[model samples]
Target: MKSYEEINEKIRAGRAVVVTAEEVIAIAKDIGVKEAARKIDVVTTGTFGIMCSSGAFLNFWHTKPKMKMQRVWLDDVPAYGGIAAVDCYLGATELPSYDPCNSHYPGSFRHGGGHVIEDLIAGKEIKLRAEAYGTDCYPLRSYEQNITLKDVREAFIFSPRNCYQNYNVATNCGAETVYTYMGVLKPHMGNIHYSSAGQLSPLLNDPYYRSIGIGTHIFLGGGEGFVAWPGTQHAPFDPRNERGIPLGGAGTLAVIGDMKQMDARFIRGVSLTGYGVSLMVGIGIPIPILDEDMLYYTTVEDADIQAPLCDYGKEGYPTGEPCVIGSLNYAELKSGEVDFQGKKIRTAPLSSYTKAVEIAETLKQWIVSGRFQLGQPSQLLPGGGSPDRKED
Candidate 1:
C-alpha cells in the first residue's frame, strides 16, 4: 500500500502522478484500479455551487475608543457581532435591513451579506457600521468606517456547511410558480434544477469519507483551505448504492481558509431572483491514492450517482415535509433533458461543471508542481462505510 509520506515525497521530487477525477475515471477504466493505483498518486475532485451556510469571520481590530460591538452591519447587511470586541461573522444569506422580502409578491433581493463578502475579496472598500453600549473599559458607543479585506486584522471563511455529497433535484408541482433557492421553479414541473458536479464532486469521489476528514488540505476559492469538521446536519448514515455514495444530501464539510488569499472568480455573490442573496463558492479536494481501493473509489461515473427528485411547492419542501417524487441519475440529468412520469422536462444545473473541471485541474497542477501538499486527516468523519462492500 502507498502511504501519504511516499506520495508526498514523490510530489516534492516532481514524480507523483496526479490527475483530475474525470481524467482518472478514464484511466481506471482502461487499466483497472489496481494497475492505475500503481501508476497514479493523487486524484483531484471539485465542486462549485451555492452554499448558503457559508460565512466569514472578520476581526476589524479595535476602533479608536475600542468599542465592543453589540450590533454590526457591513454595507447594510447585518452580521453577528457577539463574538468579541471587534469580531463579527458575516453570513452569506443575511439580507439587508431595508430588504422588503416577499412583502410585495416576489422580492427582488439584489444585495446582502454575500455581496459584501465579494466586494471585500475584490479589494473594494465596504462601509462598516457598528453600535454598542458604552462601557468604562471601552467607551465607544458607535463606529463607522470603510474597510477592505486588507483592513481587517484577521479574516477567514468559516463556512459551516458546503460541498454536499449528494443533493435533491427540485421542481414545482403547485398551481403557481415558486421562487426558491433552487431557482425559480416553473409550475407543473416545467423545469428542473439540480446542483453538484456529479462524479467530479469531491465527496462522491471519496464516498466513505476515508480520505476526506478534518485537517485535510483543499483548494478553496482559489486558495488553500482545510476541512475544519464534518458539516452541520451531516448525516453520513444514509441510504446508499453499491458504491457507498449517499443517495441524498448526506456528507458535508465545514471548511475554513484565509479569505485574503481567495479569488473573486471563485467567491461570487449571487442574488437568486426572489430568494435572498447567497454565496457561490468553489472547492476542490485532493485524494491521495493510498491503495487500490482508494483508487477504485475515485473511478465513480455520473451514471452511478443518484439524486432524489422533490417538489419545491407547498405540498413538498415548503411545509417542512418532503414529498420525494423519485430518483434520477446524473447521466440522464446532464443530457439537458429528463423524462419524469413519461413527460420530457428540461434540466438545468445550478452548479458550474466547467468551473469544477478548472478547479480539479488547478489542484492537479498544484500537486504535480510541488506547490500543494496533501495533509492527512487528524480525525475521520462521523459515519463510515466502504465503497467496495456490499450492503446487507
Candidate 2:
C-alpha cells in the first residue's frame, strides 16, 4: 500500500499519475483495480451545487468612536452580529428584513446574503449599515459605509455543511405545485429534480471517507480550503448497497477557505424561483490511491449510485413526515427522463455535471503541474466502516 508521503513526492517531482473520477472508470475497466492502483497516484472528484448551510465571516476594523455594533446589514440583507463588536457572519439563506416571504406566494427574493457574498468576491462595493446602543467606552450609535472584500481586516468562508454524500430526488404528488428548496415541484408527479454529480462527486468516489476527512486539503470555490469537521447532521451509517455507496443522504463536510481568493464563477449567488437564496459552491477533493480498494471505489459509475425519491408537496413534505417514496439510479436521472411508477417523467439536475468535470480537470492540472500535493487527514470521519467492493 502507498502512503501520502509517496504520493506527495510524485506530485512534487511532476511524475504523479492523476486522473478524474470519470477517467478512472475506463482505466480500471481496462487494467483492473490492482494494476490501476499501482499506476494511478490520485483520483480527483468534484461537485457544484447549492449549499444553503454556508456563509462567510468578516472581521472589520473598528469604526471611528469605537461603536459596539449590535445590528448589521450588508446590501439590505441581515447578518448575525452576536459575536465581536466588528465581526459578523452572513448566512447564505438569510433574507432581507423587508422580504415579504411567501406572504405573497412565490415571493421574488431578488437579493439576499448569497448575492452579497458573490458581489463581495466580484470586487463590487457593498453598502454596510449598523446600529448600536451607546456604550461607555464607545460613543458611536449608528454607522454606515461602503466596503468590499479588500476593506475587511479578515474574511473567510466557513460552511457548517458543504458537500453531501448523497441526496433525495424531489417530486410533487399533491394537486398543487410546491415551491421548496429543491425547486418548484409540479403537481401529480409532474417533474423530478436531483442534485448530485453522481460518479464524479468527491464523497461518492471515496464512499467510506477513507481519503477525505478533517484536515484534508480541498478546492473550494476556486480557492484552497480544508475539511474542518463532520458537518451538521452527518450520518455516515445510512443504508447502503453492496458497493458501500449510501442509498440516501449520508455523510457531509464542513469546510473553510479564504474568501478573498475565491473566484466568482465557482462561487455564485443562486436564487431559487420561490425558495429564497443560497450559495452555489464548487468543491473538489483529491483522493490518494492508498490501495487497490481505494482505486476500485473511484471506478464507480453513475449507474451504481442511487438517490432516494421524496415528495415535497403539501401532503407528504409540508407535513414534515418521512416521505421517501422510492429510489432511482443516477444514470436514469441523467438520461433526461426517468420511468417512475410506469409513467415516463422528465428529469433535471440542480447540480452542474459539466462544472463538476471542469473542477476535476482543474484539480488534476494543479497536481500535474506540482502546484498542489496530497494532505493526510488528521482524523477520519466517524462511522465509516470497511468499504465493500465487488471482490469482497
How accurate locally, in lDDT, is each candidate?
Answer: 0.92, 0.92
- Model 2 off-target regions past 4 Å? 388-392
Residue 325 displacement (Å), model 2: 1.3
Model 2 local distance difference test score? 0.92
TM-score of 1: 0.97
- Model 2: per-residue Cα lDDT over 1-392, one tens digit each: 99999999999999999999999999999998999999999999999999989999998899988988789999999999889799999999899988887788897778889999999999999999999988898778999999999999998999999899999999999998888899988999999999999999999998899889889999999989999999998988888898989999999999999999899889999888778999999999999999999999999999999999999988886798999999999999999999989989899999999999999999999999999888798988886536642221
Residue 128 displacement in candidate 1 (angstroms)? 0.8
Per-residue lDDT over 1-392 for candidate 1, one digit per residue giving the tens place of the 0 to 100 score: 99889999999999999999999989988998889999999999999999989999999888887889999999999999998889999999999989998786588888998888889999999999999998998899998998888889999999999999999999999988999999999999999999999999999999999889999999999899999999998888889898887899999999999999999889899988778899999999999999998998899999999999999986899888867999999999999999999999999999999999999999999999999999999987887445544434
Checking candidate 2 for backbone clashes, the offending pairs are none
In model 1, where do residues sit more than 4 Å from their true spots? Answer: 385-392
Clashing pairs in 1: none
Report, for all candidates in order, the number of backbone clashes. Answer: 0, 0
TM-score of each: 0.97, 0.97
